[model samples]
Target: MFKIEVAKMSILFSPITIGGVSLKNRIVMSPMGMNACKAEDGKVTNWHKIHYPSRAVGQVGLIMVEATAVSLDGRTDPDDLGIWEDGQISGLKELVDMVHEQGAKIGIQLCHGGRKSKIPGKIMAPSAIPYDENSIVPEAMTEEEMYEVIAAFKESARRAKQAGFDVLELHAAHGYLINQFLSPLSNKRGDKYGGNLENRYQFLKEVIHEIHKVWDGALFVRISATDYHPEGCSIDDYIVYGSMMKEQGVHFIDCSSGWIVPPNFSERPGPGYQVPFASQMKKEVQIPTGAVGLITSGLQAEKILVEGHADLIFIGQELLRDPYWPKRAAKELNVSIDAPPSYEYIWNK
Candidate 1:
């Protein structure tokens, strides 16, 4: 009788293509917020060491930096990284270079928080739907101002590419600008940018189209599949938007859900909870998609890959809890991931 060792299997060890870049494996490091930039300034700090390159050294296939602002005013916090300034490029260039030196690909999630925008001042959105009454209501952005925001996103992409990022993702999820517009539960307007799903989706189309103008790399949009509100955006709406996004050359969608409006006061999450959204999008749009949210085990991660649920699996808290998650996952699943030369002692041990 022959015994098969799962630890050395090649199934999970396979390389995959994300946009224009090739990943060493299907396991990915999901972007998790550190809120740890240099205090009150958008400077990259020492935290970037343990926060990013550590995961890359562990042989994670692809690493996405936490949502980085495309504009100063678009930032959710003063601590968030920004690409709007020429001075910021050097820091990002260094980070991207470090990740590449480790044999892993690095990407940046370019973002604009829109009306939900926050920092030292107030939150701003397409329309003023107060996130909270005490929270400042966003002033409506005029059409001319809308174009400037779009230009800002394009500039951010150009800077990211210049800074050596391998991929670019438009952060359109979690009730940010794009998702805010998509949700009937949030955006209320009489203009062309609001009303129906098509109108709401128009702003995103323009943004992606323009970003693609200067960015010749892999392009992606992160979208909330279901707004999870009774009168909000639905899966059907996502199908249409997903199809359109694919046409605009969006290589994949980082499928996540439920931040438009909180489901309940107490939202206890379970493992692989949001897999369904990614799975559904993969089935319908027929485009490569990544699944995120509470995917916590090697077996579960492998299952998502094996079952055709998603093209890639993104784990946030799991990676934070263990920077060597990819290495550990490889060992548990019997796959070989090239470990850093400095760790030769471990292999012999």
Candidate 2:
């Protein structure tokens, strides 16, 4: 009698580890601003309670909660979640416990809105430029103010640990404060915090240095790998940035693009449009990368992993559209994913 052996599952559904943390699979829900916190006080609400754990129940390996402000003034909007104060810890801890109970790991993206803040106050930036004609010119951060923001990140990291997060991501992307320092199009300082690329990297390097003092868990940096303008950071520049981050003990580079300033050229985004950024970072910088941007299907995600383009697949808007995207992806990819005990019967049938 002849026997046939079945092929193993897709790498998209395979387990991988980063920064000493083990995830059951490689699917990471990208951090998107939800603006759903309680009463605009920067606290998690029941909306988060339902929003996050449902993805875990749907079998997403990891869920990165939205970009959370590291300081009250750092918030992008009034309703954004925050980690700036101790009072917010209990609410976050409750959410963490819920995600963990559903067998998913959780991470929080620590951010400062900088010039992008819409909370009716003076925003801060590396330079005093407005993001657009409609926006106000932000105060270029003084040396003292820069130190304060760095300290805020460190304190927030400590609060995240207290809240029991498995990972912490620094939001250095999408034209935020850190991205403002990173991109030439936005940062025009002549000091050590700007001018050359090394100087431009100093702010983020210092921020990470301070965060390292408190965060011992998985540390990831989400970066806008390109600004899509001639004056902005290029892929080659990100290779250098990725290397610097790796030296700082960063475990993963979440590859994304644009928003450093408005692009001169239009972006024609489609499936895996940003995977090349991740692939280049992994190849040249020798660090793991999480690919985000327009990646929508499990088969597409699987191909990316199989081809060594990226180490993790970050699903964004798609996850919001269908909380069970992971389980559905499993079915589409002809792999099996463990569902919640209560949902097993439904999935099985």
Candidate 3:
């Protein structure tokens, strides 16, 4: 703990309310898979106990738990967390309680890896396409299979609520099952779940509908704003999806781009590379959005909010590097923030 000269008021340190849930600040810990379950059973483990609460203590306003499987076969990795069963609730509740005790809100990213699943079984996708040359060619999902997946998501949302999460995020990005359905590059079936953009959106629409039955809390949907290929989803397409999500009562859209299939970009990611997506969605859809991807530094995060480019700054790797990133941001912005009572002596000095 240390003291710094105060400057002007910082919007980065300002409180915000989304979907009736008030957060202490706008900084969100973007979900990043830890693969730490160790048992491959998807139960919360000792690693989760230590990893999540540390950030809460460090003062992150909202911590989104990593992509957690809705079903065993939906797991991105064998050891990824799960909310598919009642047995998982107790462990998850314990983790949520720890974070709440430290005065931070916690959310969980509900996901279905689809073709990307590492579990030892045949994976299912909207179409029978493989993610890439080396990836497995997934079985095309039938109507019954699609219903099963939606039910899985519904059940997962129930479990997440029972486990005491403050928010629920649908993992619709990064070429996962929902992304596969949303992007034309991967979905090619000639049914109601395919063809036009609205058709492709049918699956996610139903999932959201079912989840809303059990969850009336702040709901967020993470999306790959662009497929990065001309044949794939474009920004205009996501604008429509964003509008749909807004109408469906989604509180926020976590804007991230690419990985709908594979990387096709010529340039590497730069700072705030994905901020424009959030800006576009926010303006066009009239919905609050979170900008993710490579946004580091308090000034940079503040700039995004200041310009009305995004409502929330979703920090990923930066938070991993420094759990006390909120403190660093406060210091950089020259704004004073409260430290835990245990560290107040040194912080006040």
Candidate 4:
């Protein structure tokens, strides 16, 4: 029955199971930080309550929450969401409940901004390198500081679980903390946390290990597959990292690129510029992967999944432009999507 149903459906509307949780479709609302969380102390607000549920009603299979800092000092900006404290759990749980009420599986992205943090505090990084000449010089993390960040990830995962999230993703991408460690350009340390790729990856690997101790849901890691500069992390580097993550039981690699340092390379942005990264990771690592970056239409998403380039399609800015993009996508793909009971008057028309 399942095989026959899938055969008759557009691949984008097909169901997929990831680490014991099954999604209703392949469309994922990629995590985009909305600086609307009003309280600067890292709490969900009325804006989030309205924002997330609207997308769930549009029928996205999964909705990954914005980059939520694991510590107050780790915020990319003062407005980013946070799960660092037990006090924040109530508001987060409410956010999760609201999304679940609309029948969408929601996940939260746990992160630490590291050198990318704009807060007025001591910033942490694998080494004391600044992102750019104008950026603040970050303090090189002591061995003790490294362990503190790892513990923070673990504790945040615990909070996410308690808040009833269906999935947990570690934000190891962009020019953020974990990405700072992953790229040699940002990390010029001589310790065990620097030098070789193995050392660079150790921070994230240990973070995953700690998160695993507290949470057992679908796990994902968003990575900057390429730093777009020489001697920086490349797709080839991610292939190796993807396999290691697969071995660590990560369900998927959310393949995004650049922003580690000033990008040296430029590609004309079009549909699926980063799909190759996802395809390469899936092909080489034999792990499920998500393709993000400028994926805006149903046919484009369908093509990526059909060609086996990626298991999930992450729609970011497009969704911000239109919260009902999934509904429009279903119409474009000629796939039927049901509206909630309150909006069932479309059938009467």
Q: Using Cα atoms with residue i matched to residue i, what is each candidate's TM-score against the true structure? A: 0.94, 0.97, 0.97, 0.96
Q: Rank the candidates by lDDT, best first.
A: 3, 2, 4, 1
**Measured by TM-score, how close is model 3 to the native structure?**
0.97
lDDT of 2 by residue, 141-238 (tens): 89999999999999999999999999999999999989999999889998899999999999999999998999899999999999988778998998
lDDT of 4 at 147: 95
Which runs in model 3 stand beyond 4 Å of their true positions?
1-7
Query: Could you tell me how far off, in angstroms, the CA of residue 288 lies in candidate 2 after the best superposition?
Result: 0.7
Candidate 1's error at 207, in angstroms? 0.5
Candidate 1 regions with alpha-carbon error over 4 angstroms: 1-10, 265-267
| Tens-digit lDDT track of model 1 for 235-311 | 77898899999998999888888777656535686778778888888999999989899887777777777778888
Higher TM-score: candidate 3 or 4?
Answer: 3
Q: State the lDDT at 32 in candidate 2.
A: 88
Would you list the C-alpha lDDT of every candidate in the order shown? 0.81, 0.91, 0.92, 0.89
Model 3, 1-349: lDDT tens digits are 2223334877778899998889999989999999988555899999999999999988899999999999988999988998889999999999999999999999999999998887788899999999999988999999999999999999999999999999999999999999999999899989999999999999999999999999989999999999989799988999999999999999999999889777967888888889999999999999999999988898888888888999999999998999999988987887888797798788667
For model 4, give the 10-residue run with minimal summed lDDT.
1-10
lDDT of 4 by residue, 129-224 (tens): 898999999999999999999999999999999999999999988899999988998988888888999988889889999989999999999999
How many steric overlaps does candidate 1 have? 6
In angstroms, how far off is 287's CA in candidate 3? 0.5
Summing lDDT over every window of 10 consecutive residues in candidate 2, give the lowest-scoring window: 1-10
What does the lDDT read for residue 199 in candidate 3? Answer: 97
Winning candidate number (TM-score)? 3
